[model samples]
Target: MKILLNKFLPKWMVLIIDQLIMSWSFALSFFVVRQFEFAEILRGHFLIYIGLFCIVSLITFYSMRVHTGLIRYSSIHDIYRIFSAVLICSVAYAAFVALWLAPVHNIDSVNIYLVLLLNFFIASTLLIMVRLGAKALFLYIRSGTAGSKERVLIYGADGYSILLKQALEASNSGYFSIIGFLDDDPHKIDKDIHQKRVYHVNDIENLQRKFNIDKLFVFNEDLKSEFRKKSIEKCVELGIKVLTVPPTEQWMSGNLSMKQIKNLKIEDLLQRPPIVIENKQVASDLAGKRVLITGGAGSIGSEIVRQVLSYNPELVVICDQAESPLHELQLEIKELFPDANVAVCICDVTNFNRMYSLFKDFTPEVVYHAAAYKHVPMMESNPCEAILTNVLGTKNLADLSLTFDVEKFVMISTDKAVNPTNIMGTSKRIAEIYIQSLNNISGKKINGNNPAGVAEPQTKFITTRFGNVLGSNGSVIPRFRSQIEKGGPVTVTHPEITRYFMTIPEAVQLVLEAGTMGKGGEIFIFDMGEPVKIVDLATKMIKLAGLVPNVDINVVFTGLRPGEKLYEELLNEKELTIPTHHSKIKISKVRNYDYEDVVNDIEELLKLNKNKEELRVVKKMKQIVPEYISNNSRFEQLDMHMN
Candidate 1:
């Protein structure tokens, strides 16, 4: 009968169904209030009052949009809205009955008072319960066989767990049986959660073996590593998955799913306390300013452009040499903010005269130099080219910023610079040194000018150094996504390789904020969360695509490339990085190179450009960055012989 009603009845006709529900609710209220005994004349006269009650509640519910909401999604928010509307309707009914309906029906004063109060309570309760009944069915399916019901266990069985269980049970998405709960608190031992006794977490093995449980659901609001580690180890041993649903915000962001058992990430198992962002300074730094981004078409650069725009920069200059990308960046800028003055420039930072010309012409207030030969293998093949671009290009930009008097110069650097294992890292380390030295000398020159009464602009130079951005062009994420889409082999350099990662936007925002915190010469090392195993990354990518790893998609390990590290480092043995106002930002304390010494070294490196002595160039980089180590390179011979 319900199926037929739903099939033939238009949605507008559902209002009639709602009216019937209201009438039924009113009748049930009287039965509960009057102990199921009919007072004939009283019942006949009260029908008018009951009818009025149903009409008012129906109208109120509709107006409040409570009726229009999907009955199957009656979350606490939905219930709150329903109850609010019901309360308003009940109060109006009470007022109307007391003022007008009572005299018309000639209901005795005492009886009318009793009826109104009792009827309001019963009717309001029934209305909510009926919608909840629909919502409850949805929760049931979401938890159990109706969805992806791999037998699972819930830990803690706390209020959140109860909410989780209800949502799972009523969700038409699946069926979640009352798999008994587990709690460490002994006082709650043998306690029934909907008649299911609370079991010890140690009993997971027994349940996994018995029910063939496919997953373990951890429901602790906060995760303790010892407990989380034990749970994961047990699940791994049993070939069962351990999943966490996390906070409500994670659920709303689509990061956590109802099917995704609300709980913790692997990070939670090994999490340190979160770093606090210095909000006031971050907002004030770029709240209203003109910012220019070099390589703005590239990953980190483009992201910088996006983030700075969010802080409402007066203007953002996106400069890149690549034709296709710059065009796309312009379009993206147009689509995102049609009114934003995002100018596209087709100039390379390596061209000193051109860069200086642009700085002078555009009068850019700040510049973020992100352009460089980033790919390690490619840079290894073209050593001289990498040196020119990474080292000399940085020189051009910094010198130009100093000349044109730009507000700040932010050079985006990499974690590979920490204990350099590749030419790319070595080159970046060289660039950092060159940029830092220039900033120091520039400060001296500016200070010297003060005594001569010569005016100079404050060009604060800052370098934001971090490891890797996840989905930037040519990043691992895009490569893995493409490979998985092609229906096969996901490539990894080595089975043991790992690197630190942060979302592009998150990294970019920190980069911009770090740039503004510079006090002349400082390399702000970003606090990258933690390094993730490449193999595990590949596996997750495969599974997220709903494909089995070995059976469906192959993950092939193809030996490490030239200059690549099995694991990237963020700090050096002899280095010290002091914290800023933000725990996530650190300032490296390093020895300063003399201006004459720096100038001489740069000249020596440039002379080697024609010498075909690749080792000499790498050695020169070592002189600049003492921590530089040439991993798997012929340049190691140069250092050995020099010693």
Candidate 2:
């Protein structure tokens, strides 16, 4: 029986079996017509009638190719074929007997027609049922041999969910056994679909207690729906792992594969609704315009590059100091946009000569300055490099934008720059001050000499500030994920530390929107919804990975690193935001400086950084921005001296 269930019968054997079933149906028809008097029915032309019916059935069944369907994977289409073949065979054979055979053999047409009618019904039922029965039997045997199947419940009771279930069952992988469906619809509660019960969301706990469901399959769209979102949260809270069904568009060759079903990640749960942008405005602004991205190889910068490319830019100059990452970004652009006009340059933003050559060559109308030393601790230890890059690099780019007449200079800033407590934040705060001061004095004389020696600046310097970006390089989310994967302690800086999280793409979208809207001298802060606790984020990530926090994976509190904030603030105590046209973006009413004074101070600061006098450089940085105070660092003593 195992072997028979394992291997399918050949086509010829299937044909013979179908023919025998049809013959039996015909015999049963005779018995019914003769009122169970089998001897009477067999008396005169019974042998000839049976032989003639078999011949007709063979011709029709073979012509219709009824035996071609695999019994173990039969579908509604196969059943339809079986029904059509049987119906056609009955009609054709009965018509032939009534028109020619009945008259030629002096047969009673009424009696033969009745038998044919009964035979039609019996044959269709048996044929369809035989295939269905075989499929059930095969699945049962396969499940037993494949070991204990995982009991799962699908999340939605819609047609798409049923189709997904059918696809999963049809696949040769006999590991999952679908118990029922879970839904939030009140109307669908406790209903039966395909013999499986439709369960309500409120009953999830009871269902889990009763059946111990291994997983719940949810459609990708349901993850975005509000009601479904709550249901998914409940399931997660119950420790029932949820698997996401990819969109139908991602299905391979119009069929869902087992590999395409993925475990739900914490990102999915944390991501908010999609942001609506002014696509036409951004497209018009960027179309055919030359654009420059300073950190084009980094996460936010690369995404900006991609989004800019989609706007049909005339040329994109990708400037980054990282060699391999720049090359990889170039390759990715080539592969994704074969006809894209992009130039990749390996040049430090702090180098005026190299950057000057780039600006002269590309003559970009728009520049997005993203290059900076962003790691808090690293910058805390190395203040010289931080000032050089974050301050001087930004200065170099702003100066060149003026010399080159760039239309927009969007500088990516951080929330850490708001009343900064570390060297990294202070340096960024200095950069923001320089750009805003420069914007205040645009198209006018400044103290610094440009390469072109042009006095009037045409560039609009705009600053965008936001908190931590999820999944970016050196971000906490990826670090936690890596630790979890290594099966050990996941180190979070503090238990109560909280930071606002935004997806990389979401942040970049706002950047582009903010860039397009800026006239000049505006510090645009994005509305990063609610702050997420670091400890809670860590715990949820461990749960998402199917591990218990402090049990399977130890989540250790390593205390706050140098210059780390227990909470990040988007605005300083002295600053307030004015409403912009965009709801998520607002302009900061920040203090501005005189361009001449800032230029002189920055020049001296640059000299100190050039001599690698880290202390003097940091001291000058603090003097320029008095709000810059060191927290839990070696430089804290400097802050004390100044105070």
Candidate 3:
């Protein structure tokens, strides 16, 4: 590009030099037109104006932030600015010539205006032509230069792979010549994308050796874990760079600019599964309705609030105990949608009286109860606080949402609820039962007004069950990043332990979609794609960061936490599920309790949690989620381990 600009600058200088050639030619034409020597001398003054005009225009172009740098790929707006600047400067010179020379040199206004008009028309045409021509030549030279173009390969022979290829060829985004695709699928072998063949994965080396390939762009959506390490190793052996593009970002739009492309990010290295968004109807019930998001500063709560805002809700109340995150959320909401009527509230969900008042004042049509003590280790140590926040806090909100006539309530749950062996999961299971039993008991009691020309409110309760969010607070990804930055062993509990993962947007979107799908007493389970082993995850991260695993950094095996599992199950041994809109998400079938009986038991448990034995609450949790079984946890030895 720099060389092309250098070539373009000399051509422009030659055009300036043509002013002298044109001057001598015009003098010869004048001698022919008037057949006199005096007329020939008039071309001298004309030659001076032509030379001065070109010099002044070139100087003004540089001052206007044009011409000095490469303008081959400049936008139309840039060209317009250049033309405007040159035209203004040329017109000013024409005015000065007519004002002074009209009386002294006897030059006419008509001739001066004609020269000004023609100069602008010709200068704009020539300037634009030079810019466009330079860009074409730059691309030609860039593509044609020996050993300059990078030979790049892509993994996955799918729709995204094709889009990635087209985007690279059609735009100045990635500076790579896409050779073809690499896939393990036998059916895709020898197939073509944009006339480029989809070769077998085994053939990547032959191509790398043949063409001297530089990089491999893997589609993160279709990456298989077992082969990921092998694929990365192959690239490293061949001294080739490996890059990845997120499936969602496969369709690049307005953000594609040369300058922007240079500032690339590494999100594609994250190996989370493809997000399957099925429940689109979840947000329908929330449209134009007042909504409240407790723990709004948190990962799940913040996402819920953001998704709710998109539905054009009547009002959104963001409540959280944390002050710093609340202030940040306030600024974000204000900047995103200035017209939105959003309230930033600093009410802790554990403070029953305060939370109850806040819920009553706003009277949210839908309440997303997300606040809880979720960190496994933290909740394990402070069992009482977890009970107070997750168990009692849920009870308070669920009761208020019922009493204040809220339309619907959605609770965010985890797979840990399936046979919970820790305080956090146990506390959540208690809350889940309270929501389920209440829906069974309170049917249509929240009707807005009287039956005769009055509003009728039917409170509906829905619970969204899913696994870990990728980059949430206290997530393992951030922990690994921190550990890796410290340049040492990155800890993994067990080489065989694995867990399901999803991006924040994907999880929250599914929650919104599922929320609107429920018809009271339904537990929505999101299909978190394949589970990635913790050991393999650390290995991939090390490779992505350009470090050799087990050599440069070690993977330490730390014993699992208090109630941690080697493998997490989405459902219990007896639990069954049926499909909904998308195959990945489902509705779990579980036993429902009579509203009054369960509610009475929960109220007794809440009081007992304060004065009675802790086993009383643990036993109630076991009863609610019948699948719940005590695993390798202190909670199982309640009385024996109390001391």
TM-score of each: 0.71, 0.87, 0.71
Candidate 3: tens digits of C-alpha lDDT, residues 57-166: 55665566554444545557668875786577666667667667567777555654665665566556666776677667766766765365678887778877776675
The prediction achieving the highest TM-score against the true structure is: 2
Task: List the lowest-lDDT window of 10 residues for candidate 3.
Answer: 258-267
After superposing all C-alphas onto the true structure, candidate 1 shows an RMSD in angstroms of: 6.6
Winner of 1 and 3 under lDDT: 1
Q: Residue 592, candidate 2: how far off, in angstroms?
A: 1.8
Q: What C-alpha lDDT does candidate 2 achieve relative to the native structure?
A: 0.89
Question: Tens-digit lDDT track for model 1 on 1-643?
Answer: 2232133234455455666766676676666656677876464666676778777877777787765656665566766875687668767777887788767766655555566566566656766787777656544444344334546666676776775665555443334565777676778777888766787777777877787775566654545446655665555556556567666555553223566663333334434333445556766777767777888889888877877777777778788999998898888888998888777889888787777667766777778889988998889888998988888888778777776677788899998888887889888888887777777766445322232232465677787788877677788878888898999799998989998887676677677668767877888888777678988878766655556787799999998887789999777767798988777889988778676678679879977865867767777777767766666666667667656
Q: Over the stretch 104-182, how does candidate 2's per-residue lDDT look in tens digits? A: 9998888888999999999999998899998998887767754467778998898888888887777665468889998
Query: Model 2 — TM-score against the truth?
Result: 0.87
lDDT (C-alpha) at residue 509 in model 1: 67
How high is the CA lDDT of each candidate model?
0.72, 0.89, 0.71
Off by over 4 Å in 2: 1-70, 83-126, 139-147, 169-174, 249-255, 453-455
